[model samples]
Target: MPRTGDEFITVLKKAHIEWGNHRHTSTRGVVYGEGYLQIPRSEARTIGIFNSNSSNTHIFNCNSTDGFLVNASIKASGSSTANDVFAKQFQGNGNLRLIGDWFRHVNAQVGDQVKISWTSPTDIEITKL
Candidate 1:
């Protein structure tokens, strides 16, 4: 049995995820478009989203709430799919965008900085900062 919070954390780290897990990946991004942000390929690599494949596009299905939009998603456009997936070309870089009216729901403005955090692999959350 764990006696303190810190001890519990250590125990959880040693145990399997089903027991308890608390880990996430975070990255900062700037809103470049009405509903999009550009993240460098290197940064995407650090966040574990970059794919060198240059053919398959990666999408991050996310959940966000601002009292209006219930669900939103982030897409990381691949090199080859960039032209077809989005109107803007990133010169082989990854493009992250908030689908639908999520930009307005989050009250995000062009050039505003936002934080992207995700746990496990699929769960994602975005916050303005």
Candidate 2:
């Protein structure tokens, strides 16, 4: 099922994901984490984590300019004491990039899914599943 921003936030909160603010006032963007959270984008490029250790995988649906659509998935596995999963999608004509440590538990699994819809600059929409 598709999830709204609030719904997605609730799910992340329940899952105990980290949260942070991505401030890009200057040329380079800065991401600071207060707890656990996920960020959504309305552009098209690359998205997903590189080093994750969760037992879950996330799927994403993305639409790009020129009517391009792509689905990206990230997966990780380990002993029952440690697992991680990260996934993302790219949409529109922009670029999407995911970074950071997804999971760090001794015996736990993690996963995520992100969906994006591009309609313009201020009309982009994202749904989490």
Candidate 3:
């Protein structure tokens, strides 16, 4: 459950799957550890009425109205952490910083940046200054 802006970018670069970044911004749907992001049209049957994943990781909408376009990737299944979370998912605003299409910023933001960390086994801490 990496949350810091920088860490998020790293996680996205690693993941390479689509988990449905379902979210509602106008409704203020995205929480810290949890999310209102839910199943997409493709995975509607698999996830069923359960619109959102507790892990709050999957955020791939493929241009869906439910959520915005988050720049990240995900791994469906492979590592042990996947089970605890989801097959794989991405749920964050922005972490990838592309500089001139050839470089990127070490930190997503310079200072007073957003910090996301694990506060408990089933929770995450987000500090955006």
Candidate 4:
């Protein structure tokens, strides 16, 4: 049996992830909590977070010209066709930049990186390395 993007997230929700909220803006897209997160890896898999609201739920796009994707996986709900998710990481500046990708992680310290994860339907956990 194969799982859709949403179904895949269901499984990941049980992982060792911290939880936080996702706030979206017209000029800035979306941010996980307040500011940048610290990712711990030079090369890593990023997690994009979106609000469960229908306006944003139908799609998760992060093909930012300024962001770099290490790898990604998108899931679509076979049963509902409405549930979906896109998990990808974007690189920017020095740290792995996360802009149009999903959540926010625009800053970091040397030797440390930033990462994002889904905390809830409308929340994301910003992991700092």
TM-score of each: 0.46, 0.22, 0.20, 0.23
User: Which candidate should be chosen as best, given TM-score against the real structure?
Assistant: 1
RMSD of each: 15.7, 14.2, 14.9, 15.0
lDDT tens readout by residue for model 4, 1-129: 111221112112201121223333355544333222222222111332222322334222222222443323232111112443321222232322232233333333334433344434422333343
The TM-score obtained by model 3 is 0.20
Clash pairs detected, candidate 4: 5-75, 5-76, 38-113, 38-114, 38-128, 38-129, 39-113, 39-114, 68-91, 92-97
**Segments in model 1 whose C-alpha atoms lie over 4 Å from true places:** 1-34, 51-57, 65-73, 80-100
Candidate 2: lDDT over CA atoms? 0.29
- Compute the lDDT for candidate 1: 0.37
Error of 4 at 82 (Å): 24
lDDT of 3 by residue, 27-125 (tens): 543222221121132332233211134444333312211122222221122222433333323233242211101112222222223322333322333
Worst 10 residues of 3 by lDDT: 97-106
Predicted candidate 1 versus true structure: per-residue lDDT over 1-129, tens digit per residue? 001111000011111111112223245433333234444444454444544343434554455434342334455544435433322211212323333245445554445555555643644555555
Cα deviation in Å at residue 61, candidate 3?
20
Cα misplacement distance, residue 119 of candidate 2 (Å): 2.0
Candidate 3: where is the Cα deviation over 4 Å? 1-112
Model 2 quality (TM-score):
0.22
User: lDDT of each prediction vs. the true structure?
Assistant: 0.37, 0.29, 0.26, 0.28
Which 10 successive residues of model 1 have the least lDDT summed?
A: 1-10
By TM-score, highest first, what's the ranking? 1, 4, 2, 3
| Candidate achieving the largest lDDT | 1
